[model samples]
Target chain A: MKNKGLLLVVSAPSGCGKGTILGEILKDDSFYYSISATTRAPREGEQDGVNYHFITKEEFEQRIAQGGMLEYAQYCGNYYGTPKKEVEQMRDAGRDVILEIEVEGAMKVRALCPDAVFLFIAPPSVEELRRRLNKRGTEAAEVIEERVSQAARELSYADRYDYIIVNGELEKAIQDFRTVVRAEKLRTKNGNKIDEVLNHA
Target chain B: MKNKGLLLVVSAPSGCGKGTILGEILKDDSFYYSISATTRAPREGEQDGVNYHFITKEEFEQRIAQGGMLEYAQYCGNYYGTPKKEVEQMRDAGRDVILEIEVEGAMKVRALCPDAVFLFIAPPSVEELRRRLNKRGTEAAEVIEERVSQAARELSYADRYDYIIVNGELEKAIQDFRTVVRAEKLRTKNGNKIDEVLNHA
Candidate 1:
């Protein structure tokens, strides 16, 4: 039987370095990034299946009806959910799977997959988070204010996470993430090396 | 009511740099290193209460009889145990308590303190561990062999640890240890700063 890969759940405030770190983590061969399925219209230059599995609302509803989605939620009048097939296939192939979801979705996924490692990525401070959001220069003042407020709310649940990674330094944060992944691999349930030693010795 | 500090259980093989990492960790103002009471004669240059609480067999037995020690173990013809009073007082003062104990004593501490964070420090490879053991230049070849064998055996229980820190690089291992500490401090049961916000807000 093939060994199953670890399920990693990552949550962060909007402006935190989750995307950047997740992108770096994707470079590792042993990890498979779980592509989300959504009913929202695909943004410019975004691929239909690569960036997201962009489907019509009816198609999304059908998947929800058939229990194909692992966790689904309606956000901004659009449906978003994690597809079960790809994640299961990757895990069965002995490749770790990563889920980048909001805090609320991460909590739901935790209930569904209690074995997954829940990581909360936070900026060094709330002021730093605001600075990053302001530097983005994509939203208006009102929108930025709303985002800052939501960020405060998201951070309030940081204690519920199994691990908290501070995004103060990119290289340090990346190293810590790598350490967590390596340590997780050595886990009894996940590491075959441990089993091999036990069975032989 | 005062907040209880997290009880940190640190365990490692004989030559895994556990002592060095722990020494640095103890220097942090937020951490209080537990002074173990021993029933052995103090070595030259070793302070009575600073390096260890050197007590007579009678005093040790009396403390044991009075239910004062957290966990006691007989090793190499000497009894060593963590003093309960100092650890409790440090915890009451909101300083995290660090226990540097062997695997057996670590397991005992875990049973007594279920919320404690158990971390296992490990060398990169068995060969490296041997090199470190030999480099000490204080133990005989046969004794070093015995220690390596014991380390191999201890490593078999790595699965029991909450986190494994590989001492490949000193700074990296220190950072990883600190990351785990920061994360544990953010846990809901210990301080629950995050929970307090979400509920109150």
Candidate 2:
């Protein structure tokens, strides 16, 4: 029996280094990173489908009305949302799809996709998070402070996630992410071989 | 703060090759395999606590009456049980404990340890199971038939398990077992680092 792919959603606070880990995993090509559809105008170098599924505001609203958007948000007078049909189609095709978004967006996805595996990446400690943010050296001190506080607020919502991975070490975190996806495939809700085996008997 | 160890229970049908996979994992010494206590007399080379926790019938009865056993059974004239105190102590001390038991005993453990992780190992197919049993050559035709039917009965209870791993290739099966353990450790209920990280902040 062909097992349906996993619909995985991940949420992480700033400075957790989850981006690096996700970058490594997405390189495997086994996963389909979800691309958002938006009403925002494409920038000079942005491609319609590659960068974002650039769509008209009317169509975006129509998709929302038709319940095609998994999760959506309004920013700077533009609408952005994950296209649910693409995710569902990819998953039904036995291709795992990943959605890396913020905690609020993850919650919206959770409401829409109850079976999606929710993973929250956390830093080892708040001090470590601050140190990593400071090490970037690109942000001003006030900006760094703002991000740290935002991270703390985000951590408050971490418990709402199904799984929490403490990103203490990069290698261990990547392995944990992979393990979570692998194990979720074997979950009784996701896939069970017993019936398939018994039927084959 | 140190995270509590995993309380894991495994149930598998005959010929699933779970024993071989478990043997490979137990070589790590990170797991404490639960040993059963019994009232049967030790035969040659049977050592106390090694083969079984040899105890008198009266003590076994007393332990059962005191609710010390997580699960118990009687066969021929001997009583056998898993002591609950030791499992609790090991888990509290951050030592993971593995309980490889039948479906019945696993259900008993479930009632006692609500936080336990339950895994069901499955063969590739019922035909493959029969093939493996036949290759053993120790059992007669009728005995093999009995086991095959019993396996079907056990498969009925597989849905109650939290995760199901199909044992096809030995190496993949072993890795799947390890991945399940790793992912289970990251579950929100098992060892959530949110509070620990927040408290440290």
Candidate 3:
């Protein structure tokens, strides 16, 4: 049966290796990873449209005002959001669109698209999460403690997502993610296609 | 995270290659293929408790009256049904159980165990179904035509299933069956395991 593509909302706490897992998943051409239009300045070697859809504060607020942003949040005095039109367009064209966002934004997207697949990547344990964060060596001990607390809060919301992949091993997590995509596509087919076989009779 | 095993309720119209697909699936030791109980006389080369639990009419009626049968159907003046106790025992032991029942029996299991995964196997087309039914060359033209009509009726119920696999290529259909099993196991995890991580803190 022919059906529209999936809208996938993915969330993971800061130190859960979500970026690496998602980066591996996006290598497939069938997925159109939703690029957030942000007011943040592009970092060195980051291309506009490829890394982030760089936009002015005026345009960011204007899109939010016009309801063109699917979900947006103000972080570090910068606006970041998924463009509503692009995500819908990609799905309409039978292309899966992945939205990588934090928990609050994911909840917002859930309300807007009830059928969207919600995926949460989780570390094996809170201690493991702290170890990963500390190993990064980019945060002070106090900052790491704060992040661990924030991560506990995020992990609390893991129950609400449709599927949770405990990232114990990288390869298994990637394979599990692909299994979800295949199973969801099979689940989401339009029932009206029962007519296809009946018509052939 | 610890969780109970899944009870998978599978239904497919005759000639849709359901037995072949399920035979491939049951090769994995993690699954306990459900053997039904019947009052009918055993066919050639059939063994008790292997092919089915062949019981007397009195015993079958006793089980039904005691609510021991999960779902039962009367066919050709004999009784056939799924024995409820063994299925529950296997599932409680963390072993996935497969119930390969027909459409009506599948619905009864659905009402009894609402969380049981429902899978429907479908052919590529009704014409293909007719072709496969006729290919057996054992039935008469009238019987074959009746079977095709019966198949169409069963296909109408395919929409009620949680997932549908259109068996076009044999290998791909088997792979899809495995995919659904993996994805469903991922989906059916108990959320209370979030404490596993939080407790480490």
Candidate 4:
């Protein structure tokens, strides 16, 4: 019997290095990254399905009406959400799917699929987080302060997650994330292949 | 803050290669093996506290009355059980303690320490298990048959375990066991070191 894929919901506060850790993990082709469906126009050199599933506003609204969107949010008059069908299909095909989102979106996914493994990535320290945000130089000082406060609030929810990995070092953090996926596959619920092998023998 | 050691309850049917797997894992010196206190006389070269904690029957009974034994059983007029204080001390010192027991003892540990990680190791197939038992050449034919039947009954309880590892290849089985321990330590309830670092920073 083929093993079913695991749905992993990864959440982290801003500047917690979740993106870097995920980028390293996705370098291996074993995982299927869940692409977000957006009403925004595709950028230059971005493929429709590879980067984001570009959809019309009317189509996005229709998907929401039909309950096709797992979770969605409107930002700058554009709809961004995860398509439930694609995720389900990938999982059914025995391909592990990773959905990287913020705390609120992760909460939504938790409601939709309670069995999904929820992991919260955290920075080694709040001071370190503040340093990373400042190093990015993408936001103004006031915006960075707001992000730091927002991160503290998000960290409060870390206890609700199934696993918490502190991004102290890049390589160690990536390895820890991979370990979570590997160990979860060995759970009794997912390791039923043993039964089939034994019975057939 | 130091991370607390994990209590690991490992169970496997006879001839499942759990002994071999654990031998390889303990060679690293990272784990403290839980020594069993026994009323039986120690064989030559079996030092106290190293092999078995040789104790008098009266002492064993007193410990049992005091609830010092994590789990105990009687066979051939001898008492054999785990000493809870030693296991707790090892874990409190950030050293993982492994309790290698049979299915019934594992169930007892589960009731006493629900937070401990319970792992069930299985053979690749029933045929493979029978082959391994025969290869040992220590048991009579009738005894081997009894062991095989017992193994079948024990396999039924694998689903009750938190993790099940099929001991197909020796190296792979050891790797899976280590992965379970590593992943369990990262669980949010035990990963409080993250909180200390964040707060102090």
Candidate 5:
């Protein structure tokens, strides 16, 4: 029998290099990146159902009212949420799904799917985070300061995560990420088939 | 600060190829093979402190009374037990320690060190185990049957272990074992130093 796929929930503060780490992890096709359903219009060159499953605000609210959304939030005056059916379908088909969300959304996912593995990617330090934000040069000084403060709050939630990886060295962090996935597969909960295999052997 | 090494408890049924697997794992000097203490007299070429910490019955009982042993059992008119201090010393020095014992002893160690990782190595099947035991030619036919029955009992406890590796393909089992060890080291409990390093950075 095919094993059920693991639901991996990854969360990190902005500028913590989580995107780069997750990008490396997704290079292997074994993972299914969960696409969020958003009520906002697609950006330039963003394709529907690829960048996101774009929906009307009314439709999004209807789905929420029908309890179709796994987790949803109002972001920049638009609804952004995980479509429960797609994730369930992918997982039931034995495709490991990756859900990259913020702490609030991640906690919501945890409550919804307690079996999911919650991983937190952290920057090397608050100082390093400040440096990365400043180096981006895309935000105003006050905005960068605000992001840094927000990051400190996020870091406080690290202990609540099942695993934490400090994205200090890219290769090392990637290896750690892979190791967690590999080892988690070997857990007794996932390897129950071994008993049947042995029984038949 | 040096991270405390992991106390790995390995258990397997007889003729499950645990010794060979453990030999491969010990090829790396990062692990300290825990030497068991016993009141049984040493055979030829069995060196004290190397083969076993041969102790007198009085001494063994004394240590047991003083709570120096992690786990102990009386078998064939002799006391066999794990010395708690040696395991602690090795772990304090950041050297992972392997305690290869039976399920009863493993349960004892678990009670003492709840943080220890407990792994159970299993054979592909009871039939395969019987074949291996018969091939050894070291035991009588009745003895082999007894061992096969005992293995069945041990197999039932596989779920109690944190991880179970079926020794079907030797290399694959070894890789699974190594992966578990590597991934466990990355756990937040063991990687708390990352926070300190980041704070200092």
Candidate 6:
């Protein structure tokens, strides 16, 4: 296979700072973090096409039917899917793309893009996760409990991941993530580049 | 399942530096690198139980019959196998042990130690591997040709490994090997040390 950019699929429970990591990776010169398409309504101050390619339900379904969606799913009655064109374009143009999704969506993307690297982000433990959720202080006690319980269940699927990052220390976690990205690039796909460097030297 | 040490099984073609990397790892102070017991006559300057545990053919067969050998194979009319008791003792003492064996022997060890990490080292390409083999200089041209042909057949089994490392660059390959070791240790054995590191912080 020719040397090309990578597709990084990241999944994490709610409040695990997947968004924050995504934002940081976008600032990296080596990556082009993708904006997904969603039928869900945008929150205040979110922009169309920038934050997400917001569209009507009919439009979303039409794109799916036309095979424009790489992976898509419905959650709480709202549809979300990754656009196939932009991600492929960025990779072909030599920029790796990041796809941050839920575990279910990550599995979907894995089926669609078998070469994509799968990463699972986890908190320290159920107790630490609950502490983080409680510290948010923006949700009701019942809602916090529900989210914590959901996180606990989701963690059971962590063994399925190629790499699991414990998101307790930001610096260390980011370093580990970057190491995985770099090391994966040196696999068979771009491994020749290193050889070329050595041969010329 | 307890926080016990792991048996790591690594295999590769002769020039892939499996021996060198395994030797570097033995210096970690927390690992016990397994020495094979063999029935082959020792070469000059070779030490018993250090270079190899030289034994008589009759003694080697006795160990195999008694199930004392973790993995054994006869190559060129000589017996070689890893001793089970020493490995178990090292692991029970919480010291990781590495077994650097050829592919055939690795398969046997995997059957005996199911939880062991099985890694295969590959060169960037068959052509590059041939060049390295030729550079060794001790081998006759016919022998080099035979080894290269053997390496080509071995490449087909690369997928049998849990992780594949292409030894195109020495330092990078070493780093990749270190990453696998560190990441494997992070796996939750019984106490989940990675989780504890996250939680306590």
lDDT of 3 by residue, B30-127 (tens): 89999999999999999999999999999999999999999999999999999999998998887889999999999998899877888888888889
Q: Scored by CA lDDT, what does every candidate get?
A: 0.82, 0.88, 0.86, 0.88, 0.89, 0.78
**Candidates, ranked, lDDT:** 5, 4, 2, 3, 1, 6
- Candidate 1 lDDT over A1-201, as tens digits, reads 556888888888998888899889889999998999999999999998799999999999998899888898998999999998888899889898999889889989888887788778877777777778999999898898899899989997788887777777998778767767665654445653433323221
User: Cα deviation of B131 in candidate 5 (Å)?
Assistant: 3.1
DockQ of 3: 0.42
Cα lDDT of model 6 by residue, B1-201, tens digit: 345777878778877777777777777988888899999999999999999999999998999899999999888999989999988999888888888888888877767777887777877777777788888888998998899888767766666666677778777778887776666655544234433434543
List candidate 4 stretches off by more than 4 Å.
A40-47, A56-62, A74-78, A197-199, B197-199
**For model 6, what fraction of the real interface contacts is kept?**
0.05
Give the alpha carbon lDDT tens digit for every residue of A50-137 in model 3. Answer: 9999999999999989999999999999999999999999988878899999898999998988879889888888899999999999
Superposed model 6: Cα runs more than 4 Å off: A1-7, A85-96, A107-116, A133-146, A182-201, B1-6, B15-17, B66-68, B88-94, B107-115, B122-164, B186-201
What value of lDDT does candidate 5 attain over all alpha carbons? Answer: 0.89
Best by DockQ: 2
- Top TM-score prediction, candidate number: 2
Q: For model 5, what is the error of residue A165's alpha carbon versus the real structure, in angstroms, after optimal superposition?
A: 1.7
| TM-score, one value per model | 0.73, 0.92, 0.90, 0.91, 0.91, 0.77
Q: Across residues A1-201, which tens digit of lDDT does each residue of candidate 6 receive?
A: 345788988888887877776677678877987888999999999999898999999999999999999999888999888999999998888788888877778877777777888778888667777788899899999999999888767776666667778887777778777777766664544343433322222
Let me know the TM-score candidate 3 reaches against the reference structure. 0.90
- Model 5 chain B scores worst on lDDT over the 10 consecutive residues at B191-200
Model 6, residue B80: distance off in Å is 1.3
Model 2, residue A139: displacement in angstroms?
2.1
Q: What is each model's TM-score for chain A?
A: 0.91, 0.94, 0.91, 0.91, 0.94, 0.89
* Candidate 4, A121-154: lDDT as tens digits: 9898888899999998899999999999999999
Evaluated at residue A160, the lDDT of candidate 5 is 76
TM-score of chain A of 2: 0.94
Worst 10 residues of 6 chain B by lDDT: B189-198
Which tens-of-lDDT digit does each residue in B36-71 have in candidate 2? 899999999999988789999999999989999999
Candidate 5 displacement at residue A159 in angstroms:
1.9
